[model samples]
Target: MTDDVVSALLHPIYVRLQETAVPAGGAGSEYILFFSYTDGRNRARVETFRGPTFADAWHRGLARLRKVVAKHPDMIRWLRVDTVDEMRRSNWAELKRQLTEVKRNYCRQGISLDRNCRHAFLETEINANAMFYGGVEYPHCVVNEKNFRLYAKLRHGLGDVDLKDATLVWMFSSRGFFLDKERPDEVHEIAGPGRSAGCRIVEALDDDLLSKVIKSSSTFLTGQVGDDGRFIYGWHPCFDREIQAYNSLRHASTTYAMIEAWEVTQDAALWAAIERSLAWLLREAICTVTLPDGTEAAFLVDVGNEIKLGANAVAILAFTQHAVVGGCIDHLPLLEKLAQGVLHMQQSKDGSFVHVLNYPDLTVKEAFRTIYYEGEAAFGLMRLYSLTGDERWLSAVEKAFDHFIAKEHWRHNDHWLSYCVNELTRYRPQERYLRFGIENVRDHLDFVLNRITTFPTLLELMMASEAMLARIEAMPDMRHLLGEIDLSKFHRALHFRARYLLNGYFWPELAMFYAKPQRIVGSFFIRHHAFRVRIDDVEHYLSGMVAYRSKLIGNSNRVRKAEATV
Candidate 1:
């Protein structure tokens, strides 16, 4: 048989086999014929393959049959076989066994973190990409080709080497990769799969080409505009397009970065930029536009569709505190009105704030939100009360704290609980507040000193409690506790908290910087016996730094220290 004739015969046979099915319990059979003609030399071959399951052997058999038919078309034509029932039965049995083995292997592999029921289907594309390409570049990291091309032409000739590695190198350098020695392991691990692919496509005389490519890539910081109607930050190529405005993680990050800049630089221009961004948030980003009652409602959204109650509270703190500190009293009424409305949303039936509120419309009943909202809301209310001295605000703060005490919810005494206690202490200077503060501190210390597995939570709690204590001592009545407490332990805790908050990869350095003045004041109070006489001085400094304040001062170091001893 000619090779061409054999090939024609095999094509129909292959097509027919694809439609065939076998019985559930049967072994499968398959056949193939191949004919090769090189120059004048001709060859013919036939093969049969078997397997424990029909699905497995049937596929292999079909492949073999195609090869055979390609080699011996004359033999197949002479046989005059239209369809074979015997072959079909054998093929079905083999296929079944093959499918069974596949099922068994899948069961044996079990579930992995990346392949669980919940995430498996959702991450299908990501998993496939990881398997095929190792790592995917996030949109933020991808360089804008338009800007890079223009920049390359202006700075350097359209040389392939300079332009090729420009974007990649820029990205790496912006991330502090070159300056910092402790590069994350994920960097190399993620780059591993792409290394060979990258090498094949691009070659340079230098081995450091890959590193240079990353360093030259553009960053997100460049394109940010300030309130002064000028490009305050440099332009980033990636941000050229309008990012999704609603419930966007990127927007939240931008807000956080601006807040951090305001804290660090204490620059009015930065603050103005932050105010502009907040205006954008209020005008456009808020999810709930109008309530059923015709009132407008709004809430903050963080990454992962997460509604961040704490963020709203923080925003209120920033704006109101800024107005007060800047002596912009004209803005105070507007700020106070906003703060009151936010506090109303934060209040829980139990008098504490919920951790998060899910009303995208920001118009839902408080019953639907999480308990954590209360913790944040309480803190916000306390700040408002401290600034305005409104009895209603103070009462609200008291009710929130009493809600926790009434419920005896000590389990929540992790970091957030510590924050709640701290906020309450600043608002309420009674002996009970001080005692409760001590208890919360001891709880945190016990958890940390015991070396519990949940040590991070414990450390945060301890630091929060210590910070609370330090703030409380800024008040006259509680100044005595400074002498009774161990200052070294308090300072260490403050340092730990600052470092932990600073180490967070996504946000700005506000948390770290904010903790510094508190730490310094705490340390000073511990060291100086004269602090008793200068308690007013301490209070004045603290009031300037913190959003909350209390008025009162200790008379003498000996008297305050003696009171604490008793």
Candidate 2:
């Protein structure tokens, strides 16, 4: 597997170099090889190798790489080759000196070069190169790295653990490497056969393009759902190992995204897959219980023992979307029961909800799991409110919003909250909800615009916020609020994020670099995480694309129609 990955990564460089006038091997004919290897988990190793030729440099680096690969047999390997002139022009010497200084500092502090030390070193290396394009004439980061890890650590106190959950981005034009969290995907593609042939530049995220992406990604996800309605879950494609773990929250949310995709493709096969998955969820995960008050409730049980608040919320989202989109209310009874289960979790005094409960007996297993559950529960309630016109659901969300506003939940930039606020304001337009919607995404514009990872939820949040903004724009009374916000920058973030997320999509061109490209060609991946393709990853990306297609593209079409009428 290591040899295969190494060979795949090297193949492209070999092909590109063959087209160049450079000789294969000679004195002072230097080649710089950057190698990245990961176990698809916590451990990763990156290094730079220089030699008279590509094979020589790879052979030299393989000795060190073999040690890591032996310990972690399931590994993803990436190699980038550059001429010594490119490295020199990109100021690689200065960057090497800085890295040497950092190592010395660690040595002075008596810090052994252990896992944490290696992680920090990787951070320092990535931070130094993510954004530095050598010059306009050269038009690429010659050194092939970025400074985002340092930026995120300094700005957000993002430590090694948090920084480890990152994705890698290769600017095909400049041969520079990037972490999705630190840099935006937009960059100058110059001085390469990849760019010169006009093959690497991504197309605009227009209606047609978004429709295609949404369909294909959803289709890939649909393929993961089998006859028994169980998802293949995900894959660490480096070794092609199917992820053994399953989360009910991810399952329900993925179903919700499939329904959203159904709105676009209307493919009957996809719908059939959706039905099978929902049937599996209902049969295996959901359980009906009678409370002390005699109200029947449905809870999504995971591993036959635990029930998560987010799971119930997304179950509501999935079933409600299924009911409305499929025009089948058979899930009505189940949906109502699900809402009752959610209400059971909510606190009467403060509207805060418990995050996890042990199933059957219904004891508190966890008080708070993640902030995402709060918004998801609210959004689920709001979505149910939209479907049934039930004030009970709306009132519950309102009470939760009271808690959210008091706690300043907007700082989390949660996508679910954005969805809830948008839905809430649509039915009952109010100042507080409007303000929350704006604040939810306003401060994160720079982060969203610059983000390199597909990081799907950012798009979902932006789309929901944009919808609220459009609603506000049309309201005579709320028009004044736009004055306080940079509407132009907000739009720019929306447009930029819509297009930039393509970096994570497994297009054939990119997937061909990985093992078993056929299985992964239409899915989304976390580049730094050994290009992991999980059900949730695809769900988030597909959901974001669906929202973009329906909201942004639909709005542009309506505007164009309005102009034509004028």
Candidate 3:
């Protein structure tokens, strides 16, 4: 089955390159064909073939591939092919200049230069002469026809070679291939089965496929929870090195994501894992404090003798989700205690909250930490409100919003804020809150659309905003606020971000390039950060995907119902 899956992904590359083998300019063109091979049991071998003619180079590479396949038939599990015509350099220099300008523009805008999920940005920058870089953008690298050797060497570590003649590079392996050339009208990309790394293919995001991705990813995450009821933290993946540090906030957030997934899959094993992880959090992280008012509150404390607002917030989220999904209220009292801890962190003067506090004694550790804690705390309160219908939770979130709006918190464009707004507006839906929700995602669409890393939180923000927008659009009175909003652009950003995220997903083919394919293949990775696969990384991706899938199914169901009524 694995062999067939791998071959099905590879065969298309062979056929597409065969069809485009000879450039339109035809004869007198120099062809450079490069192949990287691995059979899962051996170190990868990189081979390059060059000939004065396209047929000559292609046949040489093909012959070598055939020989390897014949010898290691069952073992030949991965192959990557890159073919380019040295003579197809029309406009290549101009395109190189434009690519440089794009990099400059990104720097000027303070945009990150990581190329993990920037295929769309590249396509726009070069007028379609672009491909996914799968790593940071190298200052020494240029994808122009004359610098294929430099491009290949820097990206794949394919040895220091001196070849300066190739344009229109067509690269493919397990996740399909795309061509980066000077002509927007002639750009071609083929998506493999399941997910397309760079190609604009929507079929891969179908419901059944997304469900499978969710299941597999959740299973990977659940498996990370040890018998001791704590997560293994994360991995660097490239060298199989474990990240030595752990965070209470991430543990709780990851647990929240797992419970969110369990809401979809209802797998018993996943539930057991969630129980163990929650137990670990309760046993080690939580501490109860006696308030000056003679009441007690429970705070989740990490390794340091500190209490982070986000840690307490996410713990509330995890416990609330566990209770809501498991159809049990056994955690209700604990959740209320956690909520009290969050309330204690808030400064009653201006509705702002302290970020961190020294544990046990409960003095402020730092007045501020990150922008995430405020929204996360508010979101956790909203979740608790949904479960208990407690007015205090709702009122606390509203008070936070007053500060968020007065300070124009929409500028941060945070996913947690989006989550909080979506949850808040469901009951409140006041004009100020509605505008805040819309403005949260309004101006940030282009940046979100063009961002390089999969940066999973952007999707979460978009999806949450999308939900808020759909609700607003349905209300007759509030519909006028959306007049200034380009609904199409907002929807496009959501769609593009959802699809572009696949570039960071470690589909088996791309995963083969790393040290341990089996361990990391199914999880989402941030290529810019040493291909890091941590619990929070997978959690954000899983949560966004689950929300996306829900949106898709919801749309499909609405359409079907509308058609039936018609």
Candidate 4:
């Protein structure tokens, strides 16, 4: 029965059994069993299983193979486990029959050919003739054949090679992988399953896993709240310790995450941490200014005594959230003063606001020159309007969003705009804002479908959350009140979120081709990033998960209530 079950699950990429004897042909001799598999390209991945005894290594190797085959079924037919040094004790006839069936199934998926996943990468590299460098807008360390392909592999990860003999060396990224003309075959450890760890994928965000990781990642923030209410700004994931780095923006953003977490879990400790952070904000981070223009405002400043528009905006979000949850009106005075700052600072007609102010003196320390702050400011103003019912805050959103649209600033990183638009659609029912939200988020459709990054970044996830909420507002969730928001492209972004959270997981049980072992779980790293954990990375993922969970719960309840009526 066990054999039948295993046979049923076997794919073309299934692992082959081996029965190799001890290497020394003497008692107590140990060995490391290695097998090489290629994806019909020049590249090959050699997975190793080293143990004190041949029997142990073989057993461990087989177990690893089972895991690899489970995650990647396409690599089965190309597996080459029959090493010359090994003794053949496995049943080949049954294995051959299994391969035949698996191949037939794989053919339907168009993966029956031995053509590996790396074939496109290898072919593109071999045919490359021109290499262009030295452009200011080169788009992230690229030689620009539409993103770099491997030229040669670098085994040591840095700095042993002579620069005089180098054919291709990127000093910026410290990447020194150039093939020698004479020694083409003698390249670095670049070809294999391990090399692709840089291209780690994201599985769909699981709610259960999300709950566990949110609790864990937030521990890094809440556990270390200072006796004075300051957050430990940065953490070195490699060493698992705190590093001396501080950003008021990251501090405020993290506080917002804690408040959001508290809303769901109702964790008393988390609430305490929020209060601690609030104390830090009020005592040290914030400044109240009454200018000669007779406009009084509250500004959140950094250590250098400069205030950014976005920080104040997020502070409002944090404070507003805290106020709503705690029923604390003490922060409301500061919140209104902060909203006044946003109101006074926005550029006339252009609708843009200055990035930084010297505070109290009310001088523009830094000109309003960046994009993200506009959306943040607009969203903050909209939130205040939501709580206050003051039409002026809503009026501020309308003015800033108009300037944002005219300047075409809504094209990128527009999650804040989407949230603002979503609120306005609820409050005022404007078609243009709704259209802009959908169109802006729709641009993210390709990122989802292509799995561009292994997982979405916080900004990306926030965009998806807005798109998803807009989706609910448009169709099933709020179809009665308003017509559909025309979410054909925005829908793809949500689909990508589902794909990413589901497909992006890299479990430790899977067979690893890299020599170094890694304890990488609950890490939704982007594509082309190294495998290292960060507090914000998990928090951002949780933000998306929390948003999706709310959507799912709403959907389920709607269905249940509909059925009850039926």
Best by TM-score, which number? 3
The C-alpha stretches of model 4 lying farther than 4 A from their native spots are 1-56, 59-206, 239-241, 454-489, 498-538
Please report how far candidate 3 places residue 215 from its true position, in Å.
2.4
Instruction: Give lDDT tens digits, candidate 2, residues 124-170.
Output: 12322232322234322332233344433543355632212133221
Mark the regions of model 3 whose C-alpha exceeds 4 Å error after superposition.
1-13, 23-31, 39-44, 49-74, 85-204
- Ranked by lDDT, the better of candidates 1 and 2 is 2
The TM-score measured for candidate 3 stands at 0.78
lDDT of each: 0.37, 0.69, 0.71, 0.52
Sorted by lDDT (best first), the order is 3, 2, 4, 1
TM-score of structure candidate 2: 0.71
lDDT of 3 at 391: 100
Q: Model 4: which ten-residue window has the lowest total lDDT?
A: 105-114
How close to the true structure is residue 345 of candidate 1, measured as C-alpha lDDT? 58
Q: Kindly provide the TM-score of model 1 when superposed on the true structure, using C-alpha atoms.
A: 0.41
List TM-score per model, in order.
0.41, 0.71, 0.78, 0.63
lDDT minimum window of 10 residues, candidate 1: 171-180
**lDDT value, candidate 2, whole model:** 0.69
